[model samples]
Target chain A: MIHFNDVTKIYNSNVKAIENMNFTVEEGELVIMLGPSGCGKTTLLRMVNQLESITKGDIMLNGKSVWHSNKIEMRRNIGYVIQSNGLFPNMNIEDNAMIVPNLLGWDRKKMRDRFNMLMELVGLNPDEYRKRYPHELSGGQQQRVGVARALAADPPVMLMDEPFGALDPIIRTHLQEEFLQIQKELKKTILFVSHDIDEAVKMADKIALLKGGKMMQYAEPARMLNKPANSFVAEFVGQDRVLKSMSLYTVRDLANALTLKPVIESPDSQNINENLSLRVAISKILNQEADQLIVENDNGTRKGSITLDLIEQFLHREIKESV
Target chain B: MCSGGDLIVNLIEYFVSNFTFILGYTWDHIKLVGLAIIIAIVIGVPLGIYCSVNKYAASTILQIASIMMTIPSLALFGIMIPVLSLINEGIGTLPAIIALVLYSQLPIIRNTYTAINNVDPDIRDAANGIGLTTFQRLIKVELPNAMPLIMAGIRTATVLNIGVGAIATLIGAGGLGGIIYQGILRTNNTMILAGAIAVAVLALIADLFLRLIENLFTPKGVKK
Candidate 1:
């Protein structure tokens, strides 16, 4: 677990990059720091790695103060990937990937095993790419090498500063999906920074919306979209809250909103779950051939009926309130 | 007093008769220039890398070397003569080698410093983030990236050394330059041209050879 306690960073000249920030991330969670450029998202991420010193307060990793630790040792244990895919120009793909392991003095065979595994994980075949230099690879491939290099030592935590920000949209989307898949398998705690809200929404298990170096909201993607904490978050999340909200709901949530009849004999016996938002329930009723949805308890027993009229009244009230 | 045809015939006759001597003289000129450059590289490259890594020390050393470079070669040799005479009476190849080495240090030092310093900061940060020790980063990344630039400096130093090495013949250094100096004293233009041409050819050949080596060793992605 990583914990930030009243952390603040003031530059030597008195500019505050971040101030009075406190947050904690559970083990194996993907927490994104989302903000516009220069909003201190990058600075906050750097603080975890001790790349930027804290002006006040402390950051602890697994109950040890990061400030008191040896910086090189701390850095070795934390994987950091940046926007430019900072693979050394002189090193070939395999050597770049094996950097940290080599530093820790892993023997030749162990290093080779780790390098090959990481290359395979990042979708680079060792035989084809091992000897190729940085410039020989494409931008996306270089980023993969950057990510592979970071994971070489298998650090429990990763700090990514817009690692995919430079790639084209198509490649970026593919990489994002791949990243999520990798996260699921590896379960490494990650603090990702990105100015793109949609990416934040897609990739983060939890998103922290930042503005002016202050966190406006920090919540799960569903809650952030359904109820933004402030105007800044709402605007940053943009005008398509409904569309963005869809990403928050899986097919399971949509399935739960469907109206089902308890008995085929009675037309009004069909009902929607009252717990579901009226707009979603009404859409389910209209879309499905069923007349109503039957609400159920946690044990799968029927709780009550949600009539079409009730759903209509609920939708009307919600629309009026939103307007 | 010789006609143009007579001069041409004389040149061909001279070349045919003295082929062995000319070849031997050319070999001696190459040896002198090549050895001086090797010595300069052996001393200068590491100094350049060291200076680049240690800014304060590098600046002080560079300042001293720059000052040394300002002294004229002839004046430097003249100054060295009295000091060197105490060690060994006659001025010879030693003074010339020492002067050329001093002259060649600047380009190698300056270029190496700039090359290592100019590597992208992001790349350095990446290496650091990945847990590369300072020494590992220097050996594996910084030096390799800095190669082409360092090589360029080395090439400049080498050619410059060869040119200066010829002038060393003025101080009892036996090479093609001795031929030139002797020809001048004797008013023989043929000998002067022979020595001048030999020195120029040596410089060209060394430059080409080093260039080939540079291309062979430099990482493909690195800009030359």
Candidate 2:
């Protein structure tokens, strides 16, 4: 667990890079720092690892002040992944992944086993990539290696600064889903930085929205979208927030909250799984020009039919109850 | 005035008759160039790394090295002679090696500085982020990434030193340059050609040898 107790950052004795910030990242949770560029989100994330110094207050890791911990040892225990992957060009995939383990004096065989396990976790074949240099891999592949390297020591805390910012949209989305899957099993307390609202909405268990070094809101993605702390967050999350909020609710969620319409056999109706988000359901309804989409369960049983009107009622109820 | 064909014949005759004499001078030339390059690397590489970390030192040391290169080699050697005379080692191998070492400094140091400085900033971030101590990062990441360029600097110094080392003969340090000097004194074009060819050949061989070493030391991940 990481706690920020009235943290602030001042640059050159005058410029305030971050204001009095207080937050907590609970164990096994992912908190995303979402803000515009120069909002000090990066600064806040870096301060946890001592990459950036604090001017005031204290940051505590597991009830211990980070300032009092040995910088190298402290950093080794916190996994860090950055944009551009940061894979050492001088090391092959396995060696790069094994950096922290090797430094911690893990035995060679254990490091090898850890490397293979991490590679598999990140969806790479350990043996096939063990000998390959970073340059030999594609950008997406290299990012996977970067993630594998960060998890090598299995640190309980990981900090990611736009880790998927460099990839194209398709690859970026793919990696995000894969990372979410990884997070489910590992449950590392993560503080991730991103400027994209959709990514924050999709992945963040909670979003810490910032503006000009001030926290605009720190709440769950659903709350932030449903009831923005202020106009700044509303604008930042964008005017299409209702549409954006649709992604947070699955067709199953709409069905559970409000009875979806009974299926009326229409040739134009599209078939969508109940596991898919209401965002997909809405899009299918509009794109296919059908009155509804037949939502099916994993076992291929008809759960219900989801229409655009049903999603609207569901969103309204969700907002009212959360308030 | 000898014809080109006659000069070739004379050169072959000189080679056949004075093979051992040529071999001894070649050995002397190799020794001088080799020693100077090794010493320059020892001094320059560390200095370059130091400069990369400290801004003031980088400017001061890089300026001094560049200025050192601008000095005429003969004049530099002449200056070294007087400077070393205080220790009573005015001429011969001492002054020659000192001058050669000074002449070789700029390329070695400058390349080292650039190489270390240019190691992608992102990689440095990753190294630090991953908890590599300063020393560990240098040894494991920075130095390995900096190897090819540092070796290039050494190669530049080596080749440059070989050509300049021939001038050591003027300071009473015997080398292939002595043969050329003798040829000049006797107006023997064939002897001059023999010495020039031997020096050029030595430079080529040394460069090739250093290239092999560079390849061996370069991390395979960065080969391309």
Candidate 3:
């Protein structure tokens, strides 16, 4: 657990980088600090790893203050990643992934195994790209290696400062999805900073909205999007706020609410996973010319059917509830 | 002006007779320039890294190096003689070496400073973001990225030093310059040709040696 208690940062005596900020990131939770430029989101994320020293108050890691701890040891326990994907150019992909592990003096064989596994996890082939340098890979590939490097030492906490901000839209979404899958197993407590509201909505378990270094509101993705704290947050979340909200709730939520038909009719190749969004299910039903689509559980067992009418009612119900 | 056939025969005769004489002078020239360049690097590179971090010092140091560069090689040698006299190590290879070291400083210092500072800020951010210590960043990341340009600077300094070294004989230091000086005083054409040729050959060898070192040490990722 990470906690910030009345933190403030004053630069050159007068300029304030952060002001009286306080928050907590619980264990195994991915909390996104979201705002525009100069919002001190990066500063807040950095304070967890002690990259930015707290000018006032205290930042507690596992209930202990960071200021008194050995800075290097504190940082080593927290994996750090940045937008540029700071893989060392001199080291090959393999060595880059293992740099932190090596620094921590993990046994050589264990590090080697972790390197290969991380490479595969990040969609890179260990055998083909292990010996290659950062420049040898494309921007997306380099970012993958950067992510792999951050995850190498298996730290319990990760501090990411716009880690995917540099990638193109498609690659960013792909990485975000892959990262979600990775997080399921890793279950690391992550503090991510992002200027993009879409990225925060997609990746955050809890969103802390900030403006002028102040926490405007902290809520789950759906609540933050649908019921914003104020005008500033509403405007910041932008248009299609309802769509963003609808996307956050799963088809399973909608399907479970509806009466289930145990029978499967007109077997179709396109089957929807129960965990998918209502938006995707609606589109799939229309594209396949089916009034209702099959919904499968985690084990690929047909759990129920989701019809387009139910999707429409769900949207209407949300609109009514918001009003 | 001899015919082509006569020129070749003369070249062969010159080589056959003066091989040992030429070889000894060439070795002296290499040692003189090599030591000077190495000492320059030992001093200049640290100065460069220091300057890159401290802006006030960077401008001051670069200004001093530029001023040093403006001094004529012979004039610098003349200044060094008295300075060395204070230490009682005057008037020969020592003075010549002192002159070359001063001459080499501009390239080595300027290049090291520029190379280190020229490393991408984003890369440096990543290095620090990932928690490598300051020294670790310099040795592992900053140095590797700066090396291609730094090596280029070293190559420039080495070649320029070797060429300037042909004048080392002016201070009574034995080198190809001695043969050239003797030939000039005695009006011996064979000695002049041998001296000029041997210096030219030594320069090519030195240039080749440095270039190979540069290629070997430079990180392949940063190479063009």
If both were scored by DockQ, which would come out higher, candidate 1 or candidate 3? Answer: 3
Query: Candidate 3, overall lDDT?
Result: 0.85
* Residue pairs in collision within model 2: none
Which ten-residue region of model 3 chain A has the weakest summed lDDT? Answer: A260-269
Off by over 4 Å in 2: none
TM-score of candidate 1 versus the correct structure, residues matched by position: 0.84
| Docking outcome class, model 3 | medium
lDDT of 3 by residue, B84-126 (tens): 8898877988999888898898899999999999998878877
Name the better of 2 and 3 by DockQ. 2
- Select the stronger candidate by lDDT from 2 and 3: 2
lDDT of 1 by residue, A111-189 (tens): 8888888888888898899898899899999999899988988999999999999999999998898888889999998
Best by TM-score: 2
How high is the lDDT of residue A141 in model 3? 95
| Candidate 2: docking tier | high
Candidate 3 ranges beyond 4 A from true positions:
A260-271, A284-309, A316-323, B1-12
Q: Which runs in model 1 stand beyond 4 Å of their true positions? A: A258-323, B1-9, B54-60, B86-90, B220-224
The count of backbone overlaps in candidate 1 is 6
